[model samples]
Target: MDLKNLFNVNGKVVLVTGGSRGIGEMIATGFVSGGAKVYITSRSADACDKVAKELNARGPGQCVPIPADLQSVDEIKRLVAEISKQDSHLDVLVNNAGANWNGSFHDYPDEAFDKVISLNLKRIFTLSQACLPLLSAKASNANPSSVINIGSIDGIRVPPQDTYAYSASKAGLHHLTRHMAGKLGGDGILVNAIAPGAFQSKMMKATLDAFGDIIKSKIPVRRIGSPEDIAGTCIYLASRAGQYTNGAVITVDGGAAVSANL
Candidate 1:
C-alpha cells in the first residue's frame, strides 16, 4: 500500500563489478543517488578510486572502490573477502564486467576468444559464487538479495559487428541467469539479466560512431539507450518493485531486438 517507498533502496549495500565504467558505473550511480552504500570494482585501481571519490563527493550515500582483476578465482575471492571485511551483508550485486573482440571469422585469435569468455562469462560465476555468503546472509522471504547480470542484445540477435565471443558469452549468461535463479530462489536471492542495447560506452563508441544514425533509425524508440534508461532499470531490479522478478531477461534495448524479430 505504501507505493511511495516501493522502489526505495536507501541504506542498502551494493557491489558492482567493472563499476568504474559503462553500465556498471551507471548502476552504481543509481544506487548511490538513491542513498545506497555502493562498492565499485575494476581492474584499474586508479579508475576505481576516481569514480568512487567522485560519487562519494556527490552523495547522500557513500561509495567504496575495490580494484581487483577478476580473471582468476584467487582475485575474485580476494575481492569478496575484502567486501566481507567492510559489510556483514550485500543487498545487491551487479555482474557488469565484460570485454569484447572484433575480428574476421577466419582470423579470430584464440587468445582473444578466451579473454572475452574469461572475463565476461567465467569470472561472473566465480565472483557470484564467492559472494554467496554476503548475498544470502541478510536475505529473507519478504526482502531478497538481488543479482543483476548485464547482458546484451547481441546475444539475442546476431550483431552487425564481429564480436563472436562477446555475443556468445552473453547468450550463455542469459541462460546462467535462469540457472542461478532456480538454484538460489529458495534462499531468497533473486537472479536476473538486463540485456542492454546500444549505449554510449567505450565498447560501443566505434559502432555508434559508425552507425549511430542508422542504428537509431531501425529501432522503435529511434534512439540509443541513455544512462538514465539503464540506471532506472537496475534500480527497479534492486528495489522492492522487482523482488518477484527472477529468471527474467529484461531487454532495455529500446525495442531494437523485438523489432528485429518483426
Candidate 2:
C-alpha cells in the first residue's frame, strides 16, 4: 500500500452542511481539491451557489449546491430528499452547520436558547438520521462511511463569554458523536467530532477582532486556528487514514484546551 494513498479521497461523495463559508467551506474545499464530489448546503441559496461555483472551478472533483434552512425537521427532510434525488450513496456527512447566541445571564431569552439548540444540536441528529440510509448504502466493514460533527472547545471547557446555550449545545453534540459512533460502528459508520478553538470565521470575527491579541497571548501556542488547521483534520477523518478512529473528539485548538489562560 502506497503511503500517500492512505490520505487520498478521490471519487468519494461528500456533503457539508453550512458550506457557504468558514470551517465548513474549508473542509469542502479540501474535499473538492482532493478529488471528492462534494455537495454543499446552506440557508442562503445565493451563497451556496457562489461557493459551489468557486469550488468547482478549483477542483479535480465537482461541487453541487443545495440550499436549505436546516432549523426544522421539515427542512432537514427536504434537504435529504434533494440529495437522494442526485445520489443514492453518501460516503461522508459533515454536520458543520451551527448557531451561537450570547447574552447576560440575568436576561438571556428563552427564544435565543431554543434557536441555538434547534440549529446546533437538534438538526445534527435529524440530518444524520436522514442521511443514514445513504451513508449505509456505501458503507462496508473494509471501508466505513464517515460522519464528522463540528463541535467547539467551548464545549470541552468554560468559555470567557456568556454563550451559555452555545456551549451547552456543543457539549451535547460531543457526547452525541460518541453515542452515534458506538451504535453505528456495527453498521460500518464511523462517527467523530472536531472541537475547534478560535478560528477566523464570521461567527468569531467580532470576538477575535476585539481580543485576538489577548487571546493569543493566553494560548500556549500563541495563535488562533486557520483554514488549513481545520481542512487538514477534516481530510484525515474523511480519508482512509482515519477509518478506525471512531467515537473521538479531536480538538483542533492551538493548545488552548490545556493552556493556562491568565
Candidate 3:
C-alpha cells in the first residue's frame, strides 16, 4: 500500500455505539466512507436502521444497524452477541453512547449522578469485556483491534454548566482509557480517548446557538469542531497509522483547552 493508504480503514469491521446521530454518526460516516464495514447502534431502532441505509449508499462499504439500549450490562452483552452473529472479529469498537445531566451541586440527586456514571463509564467496561472474543479473534501484531472511547473536554476542565456527573464520568473515562490500554496492549488491542471541545452536533447545538460568537472567541480556531475534525482523529486511531499509538487521550479542541484555562 502507498503511504497515503496507511490511513485507510477499508476492509475493517467497526462498531460505533450511539451511531444514529451526533459525534457517533460522524465517526461511523467516516469509517464507512473509507470502505470499512460498520455496525451502528442506538436505542432507537428507527434511527439506527435509517442511518444504516444512508451510510450504505455513501461508499463501497456497508452498514448494519443494531438497535440496543445500552443502559445495563445485559444490553451491552446482547449487542455484542448480535454482532457476533454477523462477523467473527471487530477491528474497532467506539464507545460513544452517553448522556449528560446538570443540576446545582448542592441539589444534584443521587439517581441523576448514578445514571450518568453508569451509562457513561460503567457500560463501556461491560461492552469492552463482552467484545473481547470478537476483538481478539483476528488480532495480531500487523493488525490489532482498537477500543476508542468518545470523551469530552469537560473532563479535562470545569465547564460553565452544572453537569457535575457528566464531567466526572468523562474524566473517569479518560483515565480508564489509559488503564485499559496498558492492560490490553499485550493482546494487540489499542485503547484511546478523544476529548473534544465544542462541536457542531445536536448535543452541542443549543450551547453553540446560544453562545456561538462567545464560543468562537474562546477557541483559538475561532470555530467549533467539524465532523472531519472528530472523524479524522478516530480514523487515525483505528487505521494503520495508529497501530503503535495506545493509551492516549487526544484533545481535539483547537486550543480551547488553553484559552479556556486562561
Candidate 4:
C-alpha cells in the first residue's frame, strides 16, 4: 500500500457548503489541489463564483459554485438537485456552513438562538439527508463516502466568550456526526466532525483583530489555526487514509480544548 496513494482524492466529486470563505474555502482549496472536482455553495453567489474562479485557476481539478441559502428545506433540496444534474454521485460532502450569535445569557434573544440553531445544526442534518442518495451511490466498503462536519472547539469546551447558541449548535452537530456515522456506516458512508480552534476566518476576524496576542497567549500552541491545519485534516478524512475512521471528532484546535480552563 503506497502511503502517497492512500491520501489521494483525485477526481472525487465533492461538495462543500459555505465554501466561499473561511474554513470551507480552506477545505475546498485542499480538495481542488488534490484533484477533486469540487462544488462549493454559499448564500453569496458572487463570492462563490469568485472563489470558484480562483480555485479553478489553481487546479488540476475544477471548482463550481452553487449559491443557496441552506436555512430552509426547500433550499437544501434545490442544492441537491443542482448537484445531481451534473454528477451521478458524490464522494465527499463537507457541511461547513454555520452561524454564530453572541450575547449575555440574560440578554440573548430567542430569535437569535433559533436563527443560529437553524443554520448551524438543523441545516447540517437536513442537507446531509438530502444528499444521501448521491453519497450512497458512490460508496463502497473499500472506499466509503465521507461526510465531514465542521464543528468547533467551543462545542467541546466552554469558551470565555458569550456565544451560547453557537456553542450549543456545534455540540449538537458533533453528536449528530456520531449518530449519522453509526447509521450510515452499513451503507459505507463514514461520518466525522472536525472541532477547530480559533482560526483566521471572517467569523473570528473581529475577535482576533481586537486581541490577537491575548488570544494566542491563551492557546497552548500560542497561535491561531491556519488554512493548512484545517485543509490537511479534511483531506485526511476524505481520503483513503481515513476510511476506517468513523464517528470521530478530530479536534484541530492546537490544544485549546484542554487548555481552556488553565
Candidate 5:
C-alpha cells in the first residue's frame, strides 16, 4: 500500500454520533476530507441535516445525517438498523455523543448523575454492541474497523473543576475503552479513546469565560485546543495509519494533565 493511502479513508463508511457541532463536527469533516462516506447523528435532525449539507459541499466525500438520541437504547437500535441497511459493512464508529452536568457533590441530584453516565458510558457500550457485526464483517489489519470513544481530560487526571459526576463517568469510560479493546482485538476491531482538554466549543467557552487567560497560561502549550487537534487525532485512529494503536487513551490536552500546580 502507498504511504499516502495509509492515512486515506477512501470508500470507507463511518458513523459519528453527536456529529453536528463542536468536536463531533470536526471529526466528521476530517473523515469526509479523507474521502470517507460518513453518516452523522444527533438528537436534532435539523442540526444534523444542516451540517451534513455543509460537509457534502466541501469535497467528493458524502455525509448523511440520522437523528437519534444517544441517551436512549431503543433509539440506538433503530439507528443501527437503518445504518446496516445502508452499508453491510461499517469501517468506523465514533462514539462522540456525550453529556455532562456540574453540581456540588452534596447536593447533586441522582437524576443528574444518572443522566451523565447513561449517555457517556452506557450509551457508548450500547452503540458498540450494535455496530460490532458490521465492523467485524469489514475487518482488516491494514485498515481494520475502529471504535473511537471521545473521553475527557477529567477522566485521566483529577478534574480542575468540580463536575463530580462528569469526572467519574469519564474515568469509567477511559477504563471501558481498554476493556473493550482487549475483548475486540481478536475480532479485528480496534478500540481506543481521545481525551481532550479545554477547547473552544459551546461547552468549554463557559469555562474559558470564567477562567480567562489564566487557564491558557497554565497549560504547557499555552493555548486552548482547536478543531484540528481533535480531527487529526480522530482521523489517524480511524485510518490505516493507526492500525497498530488500540486500547489507548491518546490525550490531546495542551499538557494540562502533566503540569504541576506548585
Candidate 6:
C-alpha cells in the first residue's frame, strides 16, 4: 500500500444521500473524479438522474442515482436493499441531506422543529443503521470503510440569530457522530463528520445575497466556503488515508470558528 495511494478511492463504491445539489452534489462529483463508483440518492428522481448522467459522462467512474427520500425509513431500507442487489458491499456513505427554516424563536412553530429534526437527525440515524451491514462487509485487509456525516459550524457555536431548531438538531448530530464512531470502531467502520462554513449553495447563497459583505467582513478568512473545500474533506475521510481517524469532526470553516471574540 503506497502512502499516497491511501487517499485513492478508486474502485470503491460510495453512496451519497441528498446528492442532487449543494454539498451532496459536490461530494459526488469529487468521488467520481477520484475514481469511485458513486450512487446518489434524493427525493427528486429527475434531479438525481440529471446529476448522475452528468457525472458518469465525465469519468470512468460510474454514478448511479437511486431515488429515495431519507425521511421515509422504509424508503431508506429499500434503497439500501437495491444498492445491495447491485453491489455486494458498500465502501462509503455520506449522509448529507438536510434543510432549514429561518424564523424568530417565538414565530418558529412546532412544525419547523419537527421537520428539521426529522430530516437532519432522524433520517441520518435510520439510513446509517440500514447501511451498517454493508459497510461492515466492505471493511478489509488494508483499508477500512467509513461513514461521513455532514455537519455545520452553527452546530458548534451560536450564529447570532434564529435557526434554533436547525442549529440544535445539528449539534445533536455532532454528538451522535462521536457516539457512533466509538461503537462502530471495533467493526473497522470509521465514523466522522465535516462541519462546513458558508458555501455557495442555494441555502447559503440566499444568506450571502442578503448580507454578503457584512458576513464576509466578519470572517477571519474574509470569504465563505467553496464546494471543493467540502469535497476535499469528504475524499480524505472516505479514503484509506483517513482510516486511523474516527469520531473526529473536521471543521472546514476557513478559520471562522477560531476567530477571537475580542
TM-scores of the models, in the order given: 0.98, 0.98, 0.97, 0.98, 0.96, 0.96
Tell me the tens digit of each residue's lDDT in model 3 across 156-177: 9988999999999999999999
TM-score-wise, the better of 1 and 6 is: 1
Tens-digit lDDT string for candidate 6 (1-262) = 6887867888989999889999999999999998999999999999999999999999778899999888888899899999999998999999999989799877788988999999999889999999988998868635688999999988988887699988898899999999999998888889999988888886787888999888788788898877778888998888767888899999998877777264
Clash pairs (backbone) in predicted model 2: none
For each of the candidates, the C-alpha root-mean-square deviation to the true structure, in angstroms, is 0.9, 1.0, 1.1, 0.8, 1.3, 1.4
lDDT of 5: 0.89
Query: On residues 180-249, what C-alpha lDDT tens digit does candidate 5 reach at each position?
Result: 9999988889999999998887677788999959989989989999888998998889877898999999
Error of 6 at 57 (Å): 1.2
Q: What global local distance difference test value does model 3 have?
A: 0.92
142-171 per-residue lDDT for model 2 (tens digits): 899999999999999999899999999999
lDDT of 2: 0.93
| Candidate 3 deviant stretches above 4 angstroms | none
The lDDT of each candidate is: 0.93, 0.93, 0.92, 0.94, 0.89, 0.89
Better of 2 and 5 by lDDT: 2
Q: What are the per-residue Cα lDDT tens digits for candidate 4 across 132-211?
A: 99999979888899999999989998877899999999999999999999999989999999999989999999999998
Worst-scoring 10-residue span by lDDT in model 1: 199-208
Lowest-lDDT window of 10 residues in candidate 5?
A: 1-10
